[model samples]
Target: MNLNNIHNVYFIGIGGIGMSALARYFYVNKKHVVGYDKTQTNITNGLIDLGIEVHFEDSIKNIDSKFLNSNNTLVVYTPAVPNTHSELNFFLSKGFYVLKRSQVLGLITENTFCLAVAGTHGKTTTTSILGHLMNECNVPVTAFLGGISENYNSNLILNGTDVSVVEADEFDRSFLTLSPDLACITSMDADHLDIYGDASELEKSFKDFSKKIKPNGKLFVKNGLPLTGITYGIEDDSDYSIHNIKIENGTYIFDVKTPKTVLENLQFNLPGRHNLSNALIALAMAVQYGCPHRQLAKALASYKGVKRRFTYHIKTQNLVFIDDYAHHPEEINAVYQAVREMYPNKKVLAIFQPHLYSRTKDFADDFAISLAQFDELLLLDIYPARELPIDGVTSEWLLNKVNNKNKRLVSKDELLLEIHKTSANVILTIGAGDIGEEVKHIKKELSIAS
Candidate 1:
């Protein structure tokens, strides 16, 4: 596809994080960008502010006339959209050039030195840090991230395009479409069971993605993951490791040992050992991409973090509220660990909205174990994003499994009232669905009480 000659870009689901980044990119490039999302969000509002026309309906009439022309307009759709979606079907039936977001990214980044971060978790933070490090080192780079970076306030980071950074998403086998000069697998946790059917199949897909790294390129893997790559971990011997960790005034100070040299006294403003691993992998990749070690170390200290990934909504001496997108049980465990480490003496309350039906069914016991770590638990109804309700997999079922004595399923409205009545100091709202929409309101209410 001749990207330069293209004047119009249309997205079937423009409200999505990844899709919004692409829309922002095209809009900034002066293309007429328009799209259809089933609902509007902060992302959609941001796009509207950027002069990109976005509508909330799925009908063909919502599509712009200029975007209807098959030759000049490139249609991009997220796989999450239903197959019978009217807007997507219209583009297909009209013989328009339709591409998944991954295909479009693959085509756009083909000529650049692509640094693709692929994994079940940590992709967003890792990619964002790599983008920041590259830019800090004065490397001309453009990064299409999975979430909004607090530093840039946008998912897409644009610089002179000598190198491109992207989240190599594993859903729908999207990362397989990209040939990356450098790649990293931050984790291989079982997720998207509806797509892969089992954990082993998901591991197979990640293995395939690892092989897509360029011939002379380096592959960074988290320690103990079943992949042959330059390894990274905390307090473990790997190609890259963060050692001598200490928390001074709520900030993590550590040192990193790389294949060639040890970069000492690296500071990460983010909490969690997982975050330190994420930082190390990002640092390793950026250094391999020719970023200077000192600059990368400095950038690590200043990189704020990705939104909804350990986001601090309320941080005072007595109260701490964290919002995270941790839907899976393993991710929930990580979030629990992070919160516990940050506020060891404070009582922690966790409010979780389980994401998909199949995922909850597959990991019900694990979720129970992880959620049990919290002192108080508020469970919401499952946010069935694409799946219909499965029998025996309701949020109530998962709530019953939680070993915590103080756990109950509550609606968002009841949650607000319930939280207002609670006395817990450390509160966490965890999920991967519309639960995030409640974070702002919850934070506001928590702030007033605190």
Candidate 2:
């Protein structure tokens, strides 16, 4: 569908990170943007600040009448929105033009030189890094990110529209809709089991996405993934690799060995080997796209990082508090590695709120193992995003499997109290749920205490 023909763009779940990016895109493009979300959030507040109409209610009357026109209005809904949502149902029964958020993303980027990042993990960080690199290098690019970039303080990087950067999400096999000119797969871990039912199917979906790359386009894969593409890794003989890594004053000083030459003394600020690997792939992609290595290195160094991807709310000599959007087991392990690597001597306290019941149940043992690595743990009830409670799957059940003696189940109301009792020097709020909402309060309390 041609976006130019659409006069009004309406979003059913406009507050979502991905959806809000699209809303911002259309709004800047001079479309009359209106949306409905079940809850009001910081994202919604930002949209409202931009003069985009947003409401929390689900009723039909909440929608503006101009969006009711079937011919000129376009409806976009997120997959997370239930089939029973009133606004979505109204649009469907009224025969309005409707599409999933992914479909709209595909349509908008199809004509541009699209660069898609796909994986169960690292999609947001890698995409944000790539977007920053291309934008700083003066590429006429528009990037729709899965998280708010700290550099731009926005999800949609609106430099120009000749090149488009986006996260090729794997949930619901959404990435299949886009035909990318340049693509990368950071990982193919077993995730979204509730949707794919098994790991093999998820891998199959990534393979299908690789085929969606346009003719004469290139695909980049993490060195060990079971795919044929230019490989990137850290300290290895991959097609593109980062070697001679050193951390000085919390900044990584490494050299990238591309297929052609070695670019040395490149500096990156984000912590963790996973982030180093992420920076590597982004660098590889930009290098292949003909961006000068000198400019790419400067842009990579300037990238602040995506919000909630190891965001530090408080960093002092006595106390350190970090927050991350790490829900899956692999993601949790990565967080653990980063924390341990950074603060090897400090006692770390991890407060976690499990995201979905299906995900919690599917990876309970792995989750338990990952969380047990912390010095102390405060487990909150699982946040049921799009799924109902599973009978045997509960935070208490998962907490019991954790081998750590300092672990205990806690409520959100008592979260601060439990955290205050811990003598740990490092405090971590880890999860993909409403745990993020507690970051500011926790930081304030910790700052006063310190």
Candidate 3:
């Protein structure tokens, strides 16, 4: 269906990171945007500030009558929303043109020069960086990111519409919705097992995503992943590689060698080798799309990173505090590596909240091993994003598997007191859930304690 024909947009689960970006997009483009969220959040508040009505209640009566018309109304919903959601069921009952957020994203990109970033991890940072580069280069672009960019302070970056940048989410096999003109799979690590049920199945889904790229379009994959594509890695023999790496004053100074040229002294402060690989894929794709090499490097230096993705709230000579959205074992390992690299010899404390109970149960051993890498580990109860808690899949259950002697379960209320007890100098909060809401409190307490 042509988006131009839709006059009103209604969203279910409007508070979600990806959903809110679409809500903002249609709102800015002059559509009457309104929706329902399970709760009020900073994101929903921002949308309300933009004059889009959002209600926390799940009643059908909350939807504006303007969006009740099936002919002109476009109903969008996230998979995270329960199938029994009242507003959603009501729309379905009335025979409205309801669509999955992913389907709508595909429709939006169907005619545009779309560049999609897909992965179990790194998609947010990579997509955000790519969008920033294209925007700085004055390319006509609109990026729908998975996380709020620190530079733009928003997840939706609307520079123009000729180019569309999107996070091709793997959950629910959502990436398959896009027909990307150029795409990259940063890592196809098994994820959302609750959806895919097995690692091989997840990999097959990624391969299917690769097939969705336009016939003439380019595909980039991180080195060692199973799929075929232009590969990228650090100090490796990939099509695009990073070399001459150094860290100065907490920033990365490196050079990138693409198929066409070597761009030297490219500075980035995103704080991980994994992130450098992410930036490299973004750089290679942008260069392939005709962005000048110098412009890409210049934009890389100014990239402030996405919020909650290795975001530092307090950094000083005496102590350091960082927060990240590293919910998976591989992602947690990368965070640990980066933190250790950044602050060698300093005691690093990690506080992690497992995002889903099913994921926790599936990767409990792996999670235990990764969490053990920190100087100290504090595990919180699993944050059940969508799934019901599996029997025996709890923080204490995972904490027992941790080989670290300095590990303990933590409660949100007593968390401040517990942190003060630990003598760790570098404190990191890692998760993909409501643990973010506690960051401000943690930061304030740390500032006073330090």
Candidate 4:
């Protein structure tokens, strides 16, 4: 199966962040790109605006005739698409050269020198930072990222062909499909219990991914992670470490101690120690790939961050509003920690929409403790992305365990009303699901109120 032979590329889940990046890759490469998604999103619209066709319905009839030829057409679907999806079933029945999104990503990067970033959290931010680092240094590279990079305004960053940077997604053990020349596992927390069922299996899967690295290729792991690799941390004993960390005007002024030398007074704009660690790993990867330390530091300092990962919708001395894609308990804790550090003692209002029922149920206690850190909480119903409701798993149930007097469950319609009711100074909207779609509305109302 040579990718060169494929003339038409049809994606069953083209609107997904990862899928849309691939769709754009195919379109930019002059393939006849078309696909179907269950909804029309900014991603799908961007593809359509570039002349790629997309349909929202799941019906088989919506598939264009140009993609019917088995000899020249390639069909790709995400794992999130159910087995019962009509368009996917049609493609499978017709014996199209169908592939999972990860499989196709693997095939595309198989020949390229790939740097894959894998983690339960921080994958997007790390990948984006790596992509920006390589690009800024004028390396010939392309990156397929999981989130839209604020610098590029797109998930697919195309520089040249010598290198590839991608998020090594662990949702369905998808990162294992990639054959990476260099890789990093920033975390190995328990997630996607619907797939792995337990944390031990999840850690084993991370180990499996490390073994897939090409011979003589390097692997980087965050300090204290079970996997052995070039280690990185802030103010810790690792192969790569950062120290003298201080926030000056909301930016980090730190010194990094690498095996080679110590670079001082480096600047980083993103908040959170997690992101500081993320930047360190990306810097380590770029330097390992032979990027100049000076150039890498400059790039990391300028990276605007991924759109939904600590994205600043409004930043003023009077009020600050940040939107983040923090679905899991660890992620939520990071957000609150960053918020508290940045604006200590301020009234921090966090409106969290639980991503999936299974996750909310599995991590209820952890989530409760994390949310309780905020001064006020507005919990929304669980956003069931690819799952049905789990009995006894609801926002009210999670809210009851929060152990905070200022927490309440609310609906989307009442979100604005509830937010308006609060006189909080710092506002945070955290989650991974459709909560992102509401960012615009929330930003607008906050701006108008200001």
lDDT of candidate 2 vs native?
A: 0.94
lDDT of 1 by residue, 1-450 (tens): 899988989998999999999998888788989988889899999999888888887788887678768988899999989999998988899988899999999988889999999999889989999999998888888899999999999999998777999999999899999999999999888888889998999999999998888898888888899999888888988888888999998899888888888888888998887887788889989878777777777888899999999999888888888999888888888898888888888899899999999999989999999999999999999998888999888999998888888988899889899997678998899999998899989888887877
Best by lDDT: 2
Sum up the clashes in candidate 4.
0
Off by over 4 Å in 2: none
Clash count in backbone of candidate 2: 0
Error of 2 at 269 (Å): 0.3
Tens-place lDDT digits, model 2, residues 267-318: 9999999999999999998898889888998898899999999999999898
- Which residue pairs does candidate 3 place in steric collision? none
List model 3 lDDT by residue over 365-437, tens digit each.
9998899888898888899988887888889989999999999998898899999998888999999999999
Structural similarity to truth (TM-score) of each candidate: 0.98, 0.99, 0.99, 0.99
lDDT of 1: 0.89
Backbone N/Cα/C clashes per model: 0, 0, 0, 0
Q: Model 1: how far is 127 from its true place, Å?
A: 0.9
- Higher-ranked by TM-score: 2 or 4: 2
Q: Point out where model 1 deviates above 4 Å.
A: none
Residue 227 local lDDT, model 4: 82
